[model samples]
Target: MKKNLWIGGEYQSASSYMELKNPFNLEILAHIGIANQGDVLSAIKAAEDAKDIMTEMPAFERAEILEKVAQYLKDDREECARLIALEAAKPLKAAKSEVDRTIMTYTFAAHEARRIHGETVPMDAAPGGQGRLAFTIREPIGVIAAITPFNFPMNLVAHKVGPAIAAGNSVVLKPASQTPLSAYKIADYFHAAGLPAGALNVITGSGSKIGDILMKDDRIKMITFTGSPEVGRYIRENSGLKRVTLELGSNSALIVDEGVQIANVIPRIVNGAFAYQGQVCISIQRIYVHEKVFEAFVEKFVSETHKLKAGNPLEEDIDISAMITRGDVQRTKDWVEEAIKNGAELKAGGHSEEGIFQPTVLVNVASSEKVSCEEVFAPVVHINSFRHFDDAINLVNDSKYGLQAGIFTNDIHKALQAAKKLHVGGVMINEIPTFRVDQMPYGGVKMSGMGREGIKYAVEEMTELKLISFKTE
Candidate 1:
């Protein structure tokens, strides 16, 4: 199949193309057009030109367009899921879930579109002259650049694009090269929904080639990206004064306290650690179990991990699949080897079969090892024992990342304590760090990146606040 870049509301061919393959089987999926510097500039120009049309559009009209896109996606959900599975090698069930979430994201954006209002400020209360009225209104930030990742290509793109459009801002999307087809399809949906030409432009290709163009362009008012901390930092430093919302990497942790139901939490933990081969930014990479329940937790977690079916993602029963690239697979192997070499015990799944790494678990891993300290971004997790609940919280907080963490505890005080002391963006009691709904504010702190990404929060980021004051006679 041949795919062209979606720029200026049309399918335009580029001078070159890159082959997109199914990561699991190496099957060629499509020849995706590679956007060059000129292409990126054209996309930005298109977005800049359409800024006024989008900003001047009424709130209800924007909501209507978003609703139509949601309906269109719902109609073609199955094909969309298949595309995601083929491109990202995500399991069919997980891909379907992503599609559902994408729909929900757009639906939420539609709802938020109509309710994007600012509050009236009390001028008198601020020591202003008595007869003054003050209020604020939100306005689009104009030409936004959305750079999404390979994981959850559709939904992550929706998280950025849906809100940007809903807030009356034009978007220039740069989906991950590994998963650009889904973005193209979404652009098609927006087109069919009667979005104005040039309002949404998709440039597909190498990030190194086109990313700087988007970041440095003064016309683009905001840059919303979801990727690694390295790239996030690069964008932040080089983008000059542009508004940025980065959803970066994380080494999410979970704490399992004593006296909790071990069997009940094991499956959820397995799913959290290994789902999509642990590509999720919030995938649980570390587990600090209370010493009292360490052995039982590890045994049950490994048993559940062993039962996971790993193979072609297109198969409905498959639970895991290949990582996005061969380099990632090798990196995962290296990290696991390094951890084991440092005296960590690999309790289960230390090898790869058919290019797919097994769900790996390690115990006694030192906190300084790469697997434990860094964002593994693979299906490998380390288990450690902590004697006290405070120790577990300290261990979870010791990392440079502050994305999200979870604790399995029946004690309300302990849960609340974890919530207060985890030092992350969010804390989940009796739940995995992977727990996230479409409408909740989701982002990280510290190196995990800045800003929130729920539909409402994202709309707020995509817009600028303007204060208007009037003097009463």
Candidate 2:
């Protein structure tokens, strides 16, 4: 199947190409046409001029268009899911779930559009301002550049695009080369929903090659990026005069306090650690369990992790999908090796036989290990024991990544204490570090990322606040 780039509401082809590999067997599914620098410029030019779609379109009309797009998403569920599994090599279930969430994101944005009204301030309430009237207004920034990641490719795009529409902004989308097709399907929804041409555009290519051009162009008013910290930095450094929001990678940790129910949490913890082959930014990369339950937790966690059936997500019963590429598998294996060399113990599934690395768990891993510090972006984790709740919290806070963390404890005080001290962007008490609400403020701290995603927070970041005050006459 040939995949086409969605440009200015039409399917277009690229001059260059990159192979989309099936992570399970290391075979090419299809070749994605990589966009050239020229294509990048075209997208930017279109976005710069398309501001009328956001600023001129009525709010209710904008909301209606997004609602139609959301309905179209439901109509094309199977097709979109196939594209996701083909590109990102995710399991069918997870891919379907992402599509489902994308649909909701669009619908939610439609509903949120009405909530964007500005408020009028009474001058009588202000000091020395009798007979004066003041007010605040929310308007769309002209052009939004959305840079999404490989994991949750569809849903992340929705998180950016949905908010852009709700806030009355024209958007230029740059989806990950590995998983760009899903975004095209989204563009199709816009087309089917009768959105005006050039309101939203999609360009698929090397982020490094096309990204600099987009960032440097003054047309791109706001950049919402979901990728690695290193690349996020490049965007921020090169983006001279544009507003930017980043959702970079993370090695988020999870703490299990003493007196927690070990059996009750073991299975959930294992799933969180290995879900999506651990490609998720907020997946549990580090686990700090109390010394009392450390040995038992390690054994149970490993045993349950082994229960996961790893294969193609397209398969009927596989528990985990393949890695995105052979290189990803190799890197994950290498990190495990380095962690072991740095005094971490591999309890299960540490070797890489093919593109599919086994679901791995490392115990007694030192703080010095890369598995504890870097974002592995694969199904490998470091599990260690903590002597005290404070120690566990401290260990979890030691990393530069602060995207998300969680604690499992029945005691309300312990949960609250950990929630207050975890030092991450989002903390989940009595759960693993993988929970997120679509409307909540979602971002990271330190190297994890800058700025928040989710629709409301992104809207705040994507817009320039302007307050108008009137002189008393």
Instruction: Evaluate model 2: give its TM-score.
Output: 0.96
Q: Which ten residues in a row have the lowest lDDT in candidate 1?
A: 121-130
Error of 2 at 257 (Å): 0.9
lDDT tens per residue, model 1, 1-473? 88998999999999999999889989899999999899999999999999999989999999999999989888998999999999999999999999999999999999999999999888787555568888999999999999999999999999999999999999999999999999999999999999999999999998977889987789988999999999999999999999999999999999999999999889999999999999999999999999999998898988899999999999999998999998899999999998898899999888887679999999999999999889999999999999988889899999999999999999999998998888888898889999999999999999999999999999999999999999995
Instruction: Provide the clashing-pair count of each candidate structure.
Output: 0, 1
For model 1, what is the error of residue 456's alpha carbon versus the real structure, in angstroms, after optimal superposition?
0.5
Specify the highest-lDDT model's number.
1
Give the poorly placed runs of model 2, Cα more than 4 Å off: 122-126
Model 2: per-residue Cα lDDT at residue 241: 76
Work out the TM-score per prediction. 0.99, 0.96
RMSD of each: 0.8, 1.6
Query: What lDDT does each candidate get?
Result: 0.93, 0.83
